[model samples]
Target: MNSKIYFDGSIMTAELIGEIDHHSAKNARMEIDALIQQKKPAELRLDFSGISFMDSSGIGLIMGRYRMMLLYGGVLRVVNVPHDLERIMILSGLGALDIFERQGEVYECT
Candidate 1:
């Protein structure tokens, strides 16, 4: 997995690239968790435009981040999910959350 995290004050944006599978889930989660703890963002955006594949591990990653952010009263936004992952998100009933298609941008929150 390829990833980078950018933070502007309390707003953190994580960009995920390449395949999101068991192979990279551990490292990815560590890095993202580190960033989240360091930044303590009021809002976190997980950008998935560059993610080509997402398996069950990816689902776990999403849920983990969601719970982490919720603990701090933070908001999580998933953005640019491709067709297949979008289908999964929809089927999993995660579309009710703040997953963005084309309208993802920097957002500030309390």
Candidate 2:
């Protein structure tokens, strides 16, 4: 897996690439968590624009980050989710999360 992270004031955005299955969850989690801890950003925007696949571990990853941000009095958002993963997230009840449409798109999860 590969990731690019950027911080704009209190908002931190992470653009993740590749599969987000069991094989990559740990490393991905560690990488993002480290940055979150260091920055303590008020908002985390996870950009899945480059992701090709994601399994249950992906849900876990999002849930964990949501909890972390909640604890910090912050919030988390997922963006640019592919169709397949969007189905998975819906089935997994992850649609309750704050998910936006593709990059620069106006649609968003309520």
Candidate 3:
């Protein structure tokens, strides 16, 4: 997996590329969590514009981030989600809690 993270003021954008399965989710989780703690960004933009694949572990990662941001009184958003993954999120009932950002085309895990 390849990731590029940038912070604009308090909004951090973590752009993810490649698969987000059990193989990489652990590392991804650590990296993202560390950044979240360090920056404590009021808003986190998870840019999935490049993610090609993801498994159930990816769901856990997302949920964990959501909980963290909730504790911080912040928000986590997913951007440019792949159609397949979007369906998985919807079917998994993840969409009900996450707000899909239509303007930028992403999901907000609030």
Tell me, by TM-score, which candidate is best. Answer: 2
Which structure is stronger by TM-score: 1 or 3? Answer: 3
**What pairs collide in candidate 2?**
none
| lDDT (Cα, tens digit) per residue for candidate 1, span 5-86 | 8888888988999998888988989998887887678998888889998887887888899999998889888877776676
Deviating ranges (above 4 Å) for candidate 3:
102-110
Query: How would you order the candidates by TM-score, starting with the best?
Result: 2, 3, 1
lDDT of 1: 0.79
Q: For candidate 3, which ten residues in a row score worst on lDDT?
A: 101-110
Q: What is the Cα-based TM-score of model 1?
A: 0.85
lDDT by residue for model 3 (3-70), tens = 89898999988889899988898888899999999889999877777888888877787788889999
Q: What's the lDDT for residue 39 in model 2? A: 87
lDDT, candidate 2, residue 95? Answer: 61
For model 3 the local lDDT of residue 70 reads 93
**Model 2, runs deviating above 4 Å:** 99-110
Question: Which of the numbered candidates is closest to the native, going by highest lDDT?
Answer: 2
The C-alpha lDDT values of all candidates are: 0.79, 0.85, 0.80
Which candidate, 1 or 2, has the higher lDDT? 2
